[model samples]
Target chain A: MTNLPLSVPVAPNRLSLSKFARRSPSAAIGAALVVLILLVALFAPWIAPYDPIAQDIANRLMPPSAAHWFGTDSFGRDLLSRLIYGTRPTLMLLAIVILLTTPVGIAIGIVAGFYGGMVERILMRITDIAMAFPKLVLALAFVAVLGAGLVNGALALALTAWPAYARQTRSETVSLRKSDYLAAAEMMGITGPRLLFGHVLPLVLPGAIVRMALDLGGIILIAAGLGFLGLGVRPPTPEWGAMVADGTQVIFDQWWVAATPGAAILLTSFAFNLLSDGLRDLMDPRNG
Target chain B: MSLVDISDLNVTFRDQDVGRHILRGITVAIEEGETFGLLGPSGCGKSTLLRVIAGLNRDWHGSMSLLGEAVAPRRRFTGKLRRQVQMVFQDPYASLHPRHRIGRALREPLVVNGLDNPDKRVTEALAEVGFGPDVASRYPHQLSGGQRQRIAIARALLLRPKLLLLDEPTSALDMSVQAEILNLLVTLKARFGMSFVLVSHDPDVIGHMCDRAARMAEGRIAATFDRPALAAGAAAAR
Candidate 1:
C-alpha cells in the first residue's frame, strides 16, 4: 500500500471567521479615514486654492476668516495650504525610508538567525547595543554627523529603524529555524539560499509587514521631531515640524499659528497608529 | 543493498541554559522495500537519530551513507543523495507553515530540487497520500490531524525518497485516524517500492507496520525483533 491516496481540505487564511471579523467597522472606518487623509495629501496642489508660501504680511494673524481658512501664520502664509503641501514631501520621505530599511533589516536578521553559532552571537550583541540607546538619540547623532537635509534625516531614520526590525526579525527567524518543513526542505537537497528565501522568508514576512506598518507611524514621528529640532528640512521649508517651530515664537500671541500645524501632525500620525493597532489585533493569534 | 547506513551516531545539544546528550551513539539501517521501526518511549532521541540520518543535525558525531554516498558532519550535503532521503515530522500543525496553501507547500520541495512540474507532482503526491485534487487548493489548518499527516507523508514521498524517516507520524492522531494513515503508508510503500524508518512508541504501529523492530533503551538498541513475537512484548508496553 505504498501509494495510497487521501483527500483533505486546507483551511483558508490561517484564521477563523471570528478572527477575520475582529477587523470591525471601527477598523475599516479608521482605514477609510487614513485613505482620505492620504488622498487629500496626494491632491494638495489641486485642492488648496492659496499658495502655501505666498505670504500676505498685511493679512497675517487674521483669525480664521472666510477667505483665509485656518488663519494666516506670522509670516502671513496660509496655514492650511502649508500643512497640505507639507504632507507630500514627508510622506515621500517615510515611504523611501521604510523601503530601504525593511529589506536590509530582514536580510541581516535572517542571516544572523538561520546561521547560529559565533555569527549569530556577534550580530545579535551589536543589535542589542544599538537598541539600548533611544531611537531618536541615535538618529540625532547620525544626522549631526551626516549633516542636516531631508534626505539625510531619512537616511538617519532608516539607519536607526533597520535595527528595530533586525532585532525583531532575528528573534522571529530563530523560532522559525526549527520548523519541520524547513528541516524537511533542508534534507530534500534544498540549498541554504533556496531554503532561506523560499521557506523561511515567506514565513516571517507577515510579521515583518505588521511590524513595518507600526514603524510607519514611528517614522512620521521621528521625521517631524527632526524637523522640529532644525535637523529636518531647513528653515522656511513647508515641513510640519519646521512650520510648528517657526510659529512657536508668535504662539503666545496667536495660538493657531503654533497649534494648527501641530494639530495636522497629531491627526495624520494618529490615523496610522490606529491602523497599526487594528492590524496588530487582526494578525495576532490571541485576539481571535 | 541498504538504502541508508548509519553507524555510531552521537548527537549533543549545548545551550547557555542547559547542556545534555540527545542521541548516544545510535545506529540503524533500512533496506529497499523494508519498513524498519525505531520503537521507543518518549524523549528517547528517536527524532534526533532520524535527523542525523537526514544530515540536518550537523552537531552530531556520526558515520552515515544514503545510497552509498558518505555524509561528513558539519559539511555540505550531496544534493542527489540528500534528495533521495527525506523525513516526516510528528506534528503537522507545527511542521507546515500557516501562510502557504497546500499547493505551495507541495510545490516548494520540487522547486528546491530544480524540478519544473511541481504542481503536477504535488497533485500526484497528494493523491498518493489519499488526498483528492481539490485538497491542493486548501491550507493546513482546514485539514484534520490525519489529513495533515497524509500531507506530510505526501510531501516526503514527492521526492520519491529511498529511505523515508517517519518520526511518530500517527502518534498525534486518534486510534482510527492512526490506522487509516498506517494503512496509507503501507499501501504507498508496497506500491512505490520505497523503504521506511518509522519511529514510534506505539505497539500496534511497530507490530503492524514494520518488518523488523528495535527497542531503543536510552539511545542504544537493546534488542531487535525480526517477527511478531516481540509484537507480544510491544503489546504489553501499552
Candidate 2:
C-alpha cells in the first residue's frame, strides 16, 4: 500500500521582466527600435519641425544646419520634415502587405494541407505559378498594368508576398497533420474547424510569426524600391524613395539632399532586419 | 454477454506501391471490468487491433461491438462511443499535444462531449491520477517521463470511459518509472472497475496485470493464457 496522490505544486507561468530581458537581449533591442520607429511614424505631424512641402527658395540645397537639420532639397522643401512624413507610407505598406497576405496565405495553406490530394494540387499549382517569376519583376509588371501609384504598387507586393506565407503554412500544416497528437485528437471527436484551429493552428502559428518577422525587412525594402522606381506615390508627396530619386539630378553639387533620405532608408531597413533576426532566434526552436 | 466483441476482423493499408496486410481474420471477446492483455512481438498486429477497437482506424473489414453499440471505424468518433471508450498511446511524449497545457488537454474530452463542470472535473481527474493542482498549468515538456504518462492517463480517465485501450503504456519509461506506472494502472483499474485491453510486447507485464491474456503472431492469436495457467506459467518461468 503506497501513498497515491503524487501531485506537486509549481510556480505560475509568469516571466519576470529582468528574466525576459536577460534571455532575449537581441529581441529586446530589435523590439525597442521597431517601437521607436513606429512612434516616429505615428507622431510625424506633431513632431516634424516644418511643413514637409513648404519651400524656402533662398535656403535651397543648404547643408545640415540648426534651422534645417537635414538641410533643404533642390526645391527648398525641408528635408527632415519630408523624411519624417515619409515614414507613414512606408509603415502603411508594411501593414497592407501583412494584413492582406498573412491571413489569405495561412487559410489556403492550412486548407490545402489539411485536405490534401485534389485540393493540395490545385492550391499549390496556383502558388507555384505566382512564385515562378522574380517577385520584384512580377510586382513591377503588375503595377505597370494597373497604372503606377502607391495602391497598385502595394497590391503588387501583396500578390507576390502571399505565396511565400502559403507555402510556409502548407509545409507546417502537412507536418503537424501527421503528428500522433493530431490523430489522437481526431479519434477523440475533435474534427473539422475545431481540429484545424485548436490542434493544428496553435502548433504552426509560431513558425508563421517568425517567417512574417523575417519577411518584414524584405517587404520594406521592396516598398521603398517601388517608390524609388517612380511606380509608387506620385510626385510632391514627400516619399523618401521619390525624394532620393529627385535629389539624384544634382547628385554631385547637393550630395546631402540624396544622402539624407538614403540614410533614412538604410536606417529603417536595418531596424526591421535586426528585429527580424531577433524574432527568428526567439520564436524558432531550430534557431534557439 | 461480452462488453466488446470482434469477429473475423481484417485490416490492410492500400499503398500505391504495395498493399500490406496488417490484421488478418482476428477474433476476440472481452468481458466488462476485465483486464485483457495482448502480448506479441513487433509487427504482430496487436496494436492495430487495439486501435480498431478504439475506433481510431476505420479502414478495415470488421464486425465489432462495444458496450452493446456497434463500433464503426470513421474519421470522427460518435459521442456515445467517445464517452464509453478511451485510449492511452504508447509514446507519452507524442500522445499529448505539445502546445497544450495539462489542464486544457484534460478538459478537451469533457468539453467535446458537452460535460459540465470542466474546472471541477479537471481538478478531480488530476487528483485521481495523484497529480498536484499546479500540474494542470504546466506543459508536457515541463514534467518527467513518468509524470507525463500519469498526465496522459489522467486525460483518458477524465471522460470516465468504460474501456481503455493502452498500447505499450510503460515501454517508454525507466524501470523504476515503469513499475510505478504499472502499479498506478493496477490501482486505478480496481478503483474504476473499467475494462482494459492492454497491448504490450513485455510478457511480464501481461502476467502481472491481466486476468486473461492472448499471444499474437503475424496478425493472428497464436495462444492464450487463462488466469490459472498464467499464474502457473509465471511460477514455472520463475
Candidate 3:
C-alpha cells in the first residue's frame, strides 16, 4: 500500500502556507530576508552608496560612521558596500555550481537507478572514485589547477559536490524506478534518456534542492575558506570572506571590522540551511 | 490486422544472487477494439506478461508485435508506434511520478510523441477523466488516490493510443473508486474504440471491465471466460 505512489494526499483543509508556518517562522522570515539581500546584491551597482573597491585612506577605520557606513575597512573600502557586492559572487558561485552539478548528478543517478546494469555500476564506481577524495581536498586541487578565480572556483566546487548529488540521487532514483509510473512510462516506450530526464529528473529535483540547501552553506563556506586562504576572488576585491580574512589582522582593536562581514556570511548561510530544513518538511509529497 | 501478437514469451529473473525463472512461456493476442483480461493470482507472472508486451521488461525471450510489424527488444516503438501503445500501472501512487504535476504527467506522452497543441490535449485529457482545468497545475502528490488514478488515465488518453496495457489498474484503489474508474474505462473504450490488454488479480474487476477474461497460472493461461457470462457476481457490484 505504501508503494502506491498516489494513495495518500494532502488533506483538503491543509494549505501550503499553514504547513510552511508549522515548519518554522524563523525560516520563513530568514528566507525572505536572505532573498531580499540577494536581490539587493544582484542590483548592488545602483543600490550601494559607494563603489566597493574605491579606497579612501582618510575614511579607513572610521568606526561605523554614517558617511562610510559599517565603517571603512583597514584598506579604506566600505565594508557594507563590499559585503553587499560580496553576496552576488558567492551566491552566484553557489548557484552556478549547484546548477552545473545538480542536473548532471541527477541525470546520472536516474539512469543508474532506472537502468540497473553496467551503466549503474560504472556510474556508481566513477562517482565513488570521485567521492573517495575529500571534497575540499579535490576543490583545492581544482583551484590549484584552474588557478584561483571565481568561475574556476565554481568549477572546483561543482566537480566535488556533484558526487554527493549523484549518490543521493542514485539511491532515491533506484527506489523510484521500482514505482509503477516509471515502469508505466517505459511501458509506453518512454525508456532510456527520455524517461530518465523527463520523468525521474523532476522527481529527484526535490532531493537536489535539499542537497543544494546543504550545499549552499558549504559552497559559501568553501568560497570563504578559499578567500580566507587567498585563493578566492583576488585581493582588494570586495569579497565578504576575504574582507573577514583582512579584518582578522586587526581583530584585537577593531573587533567590529572582522566580526561584521563574518556575521553576515554566517547569517546568510544559516538562513539557507534552515530554509532547506523547512523546505524538506514542506516539500514532502506525503505531506501534500 | 491484429493489434497485438505475442509468441514464445518468457521472462526470467535473478534471485539477487541466483538467476531464476519468473515467467515460463506466455502467449496471447487481441484484435482491434477488443478487451483482453489476463486474470491470475499474485506472483503468477501476469504482470511479467504485461511488461513483456509493453516493452519494459528486457530479461525475456519473446516475440511481440503491434499491427503486423515485428518488434525488436531493443528497438522501442517511436513516433507513431509509440503513440499507438500506452500503459496504466497497478498502483495509482507509484504509477504517476510524484514530482510531476498532473499537467506534466498528462502531457508527457503528447510531448514524447511530438504531438502539436499539447496544452489543448492536456486540457481535453483532464476533462475526459472527470477532472477540471485546475487539476492540471497540481503535482501528483497533491491529488487524491482516486484523483491521481484519474490523472494517470488522463495521461494514457493524451497519447491517443490504439492499444493500452493495464496492470491491475484498480487493485490499489477503494472499491468505490475502482467502480468509478472502471466505468470511466468502459465509456472511454466505447467512445474511442481502443483495444485493451489488462492484467489483474481480481477476477471480479476483470469480469466487470473486460470483454474476455483469461485465467493465468504459472505464467500460462489456465482458463478463459467471455465477459458477458461472468456477470452473475460482478453485475450486482456494478
- The model with the greatest lDDT is 2
Backbone clashes (count) for model 1: 16
Candidate 3: pairs in clash: A4-B93, A5-B93, A5-B94, A6-B93, A10-A288, A181-B95
TM-score of each: 0.91, 0.92, 0.81
- Between candidates 2 and 3, the one scoring higher on DockQ is 2
Fnat for each predicted structure, in order: 0.71, 0.41, 0.57
Q: For this target, which candidate reaches the highest DockQ against the unseen true structure?
A: 1
Instruction: Name the weakest run of 10 consecutive residues (lDDT summed) in model 2 chain A.
Output: A1-10
**Model 3: per-residue Cα lDDT over B1-238, one tens digit each:** 5788877777778778886677766667777888888877788888887776676765677787887777877665566776767888878878887677777777766676678998988877777877667667777766777887878887877777788888888888998888888888888887888999988777677766777767877777777776566565442232
How many pairs in model 3 have backbone atoms within 3 A of each other, for residues 3 or more apart or on separate chains, i.e. clashes? 6
Per-model DockQ against the true two-chain complex: 0.57, 0.47, 0.32
User: In terms of DockQ, which candidate is stronger, 1 or 3?
Assistant: 1
lDDT of 1 by residue, A48-73 (tens): 87898888999887688888788888
Per-candidate total of colliding backbone pairs: 16, 2, 6
Which is better, 1 or 2, measured by DockQ?
1
Better of 2 and 3 by TM-score: 2
Query: What residue runs in model 1 are displaced by over 4 Å at the alpha carbon?
Result: A1-22, A125-147, A285-288, B15-19, B231-238
lDDT of 3 by residue, A118-231 (tens): 989999999998788776777778889879878888887788888888889899988887677776776555666787777778778787887778778878888888788777
User: Model 2: per-residue lDDT, tens digit, A1-288?
Assistant: 333543544545465556656777866777777888899899999999999988889889888899999889987889999999999888888898888888888888898999899999999999999778787898899889988887787888888788988899999999877677887786667788888888888877887887888788888788888888998888788888888888899899989888888888887777777767766665563322
Q: In angstroms, give how far residue A194 of model 2 lies from its true place.
A: 1.5
